[model samples]
Target chain A: MFAEGPSVFSRFIVCLVLSFLLIVIDQRQQRLESVRATLAVVLYPIHLVVDFPTTLVRATAEKFSSRRELRAANERLRAENLELRFRMQRYQTLERENERLRALLDTSVMVGQKVLAGELLAVETTPSAHEIIINQGVRSGVFPGQPILDAEGIMGQTVHVNPFSSTAMLITDPRHALSVAVNRSGVRAIAVGTGSMAQLDLNFIPNNADIAEGDLVVSSGMDGVFPAGYPVGVIEVIEFEPTAPFARIKLRPHADLAHAREVLFVWPQTPEQDTPAAVPATEAPAP
Target chain B: MSLRNLRGTLLIGLSILIAFALTVLPLPAWAQAWRPAWVALVLMYWSMAVPERVGVITAWFIGVLLDVLVGTTLGQHALGLAVIACLTVIYHKRLRVFSQLQQGSICAGMLLLYVTLLRIVDRFAGVPVPSVSYLTVVTSALLWPWLFIILRDVRRKGGVR
Candidate 1:
């Protein structure tokens, strides 16, 4: 018979046996970080080579765009710039008035968190998992569990931290659940991703919950990672099954996760360098 | 090993690097939903086209790397990928005879198997069963043919055998 000998089957069986041993060892969280780090270093050069082709095509396309298209884009931008400047003037006045009002009340406003920027390196496109790798890593002052955000809104959280790179779990991943609240009513619920990037589901809310299809869900700041009131998603549907107690609510994330090339890592607390001018000065005391 | 064998090993290593790079590409949101399983596709290609060169151990090692990169349960992908590699080798002969389309279809099935196996492991780790749309095996299966042709062409032109 063609399959008479131990053949490829026997070899495969042996391989499987070896793999099981490796899996067992790996699962116990053995000291493999050094090996992984070294491998990543070796891999860095190869990554550059593979990424070259795509970058080349993108650059060439940008270079060759027609001047007509560029002019049209510039005209649209100028119009938008004028509108934004008008709004900014109103915002500046409101901000100054609010700050003065706050001073009178002895209340302090939260300083904007300083952001460390990172570029996207890779995204896990496989259906089995949802994750993205950022160019920044632990060495770049990144930490596991830190929240990642783009200009639009919250994207995900850092799950794995290596010396050279960190992997961020996307909000669309099945394992991801954000504690969010309806922007209008402040009613809280958990929003879980449905695998597909376009949608998510809100849970732990009653059937009669005052949530509608257009309602916005923002971070409640209960998780201690994302700051409160950041946009998360807008409810798309609220299906109330008569028999089921919980409302089946679907949502669309406001963040442009797919096209976002750069992101900001939000540490739970401000870094020592970004702490208030008084906090650091108080510690040194003219030493 | 002979120089020829060493060259083959180098190609395999380089291919893994390529696979890792593909995993890191910046895909648009809509495209991400349809993105091919590059790591599994490339690993399956190498493991089949060169069984003597790449095997289940190699698959498991890469699987662990993916687990780290994807940030899932530690051994989850290692087990799934290793098993898929074993299956690929066990059926390599029949696979070799099949047309590119058929081979890709099978690869897609194997990728689906990989995801399913991963979910089972994730469930055991106390992660709730994800959304109902977690079954994305068919899309990967459909992508199998295209991936197979592209990678096979690379191997053939690179003179891997």
Candidate 2:
């Protein structure tokens, strides 16, 4: 008498089974890459359609220009440009000194990595997940595990790469851990996400670790994911727990990741392959 | 889909678009921890309001899409979505009579529950548990009343659903 309609429990069971299958396939295999890529391509037009209203409004606003406001903006920009030029001269001198120091120390001279600009396409929709989608992806030379940076400093690493878009797992994601060094002391520690966007927990630090508030944390370049010497965070608070062996240290990220309008993807360069060592003639006699 | 039925389809599609847009909006790094779950929230609302139209399978499909979109373990979001959809289906009759504010509160709780489930799944998968952002779920719940009102208004104005 129920008209043979699918029961909610049955439907849920079906959904759970199907969703689990999809999940297993997606996680264990690379089979869904093509499907994801195709979906991204097909979805591009929809994005364009969705963004049209905002673009139209912006275009309309651009049409109604006021001369006074333009003049004010122009003057402001001119002043900022003059200030930047002065600072640039100082930076040039510092760069020369830095180069000389690097040469003397016999260390590889650090050069800025080439960056591809990207726009935020989406934030993590799951409350507990710390991630964002950017406009750049595999198509734009972006790859998974590449580090993302904002104007201030390190933002995150690319976790998922689509054809036209990539998902950046933010430093605040509980799953994220970075090998970082204290700039002042050169002591290395792993910074893990506390699930607080504002703070990170420095794990595995000894109770007597020589760290204090305001110490700058930068990438140690040990992981090969993030570049060395980029600002990651600043020590915000430290709580010493007598019962726990590790110090409960917290830090604030240098980058304003949540509100970042533009981000840069630092593409990784391929490392030189090591040559296989030749077998000693003495040991090769049996062969 | 027929032209007459197409309107409803478009409305639901637009809601998904809204979900996507909301998901992508730039927020502060500190706020990232507390950002509300968007796609699931939209799907939950729609599935409950129009269970005949949107089903558990559909919710699961959307969750998978979100998983692909967000780059999380594929089954995690799908499982969470299925759970929420089941809840929505079970409570839809009672939920339909609640005020927007009351419904929003429920939505917020459901979203929080979903997030907790996601975290549990993530932990089982060896991902670290994110700090308490239950506030985000609460805030998302707070947004439900307004979203419900606005969406209802949009539906009435568009005559699409």
Best by lDDT: 2
Measured against the native two-chain assembly using Cα atoms, what DockQ does each of the candidate structures obtain, in the order listed? 0.28, 0.33
When only the first chain is scored, the TM-scores of the models are 0.75, 0.78
- Which lDDT tens digits does candidate 2 get at residues B24-123? 4546556766666777777777777777777687888777776665556777888998899889877887898998877887887788788798777666
Give the Cα lDDT of each candidate.
0.71, 0.74
Query: Using DockQ as the measure, which candidate wins?
Result: 2
Candidate with best TM-score:
2
In model 2, the Cα lDDT at residue A19 comes to 69
* Model 2 agreement with the true structure over A1-287: per-residue lDDT tens digits: 12113587888888888766766777567687766666656555544554456556766887776888879989999999999999999988898899799889866666445789998753344556677767787878887788899989999998667787777788877778888899999888888877678988887787888989999999887766777789999998888898999888899999996678689988544334222232211100000
Error of 2 at A287 (Å): 50
Q: After superposition, how far is residue B40 of candidate 1 from its true place, in Å?
A: 6.2
Give the alpha carbon lDDT tens digit for every residue of A85-169 in model 1: 9999997888788878978987655445667899876344243456777778878888767888998889988766677777787
Model 2: residues >4 Å from true position, as ranges? A1-12, A24-109, A121-124, A207-212, A238-247, A269-287, B1-53, B69-72, B83-120, B126-161
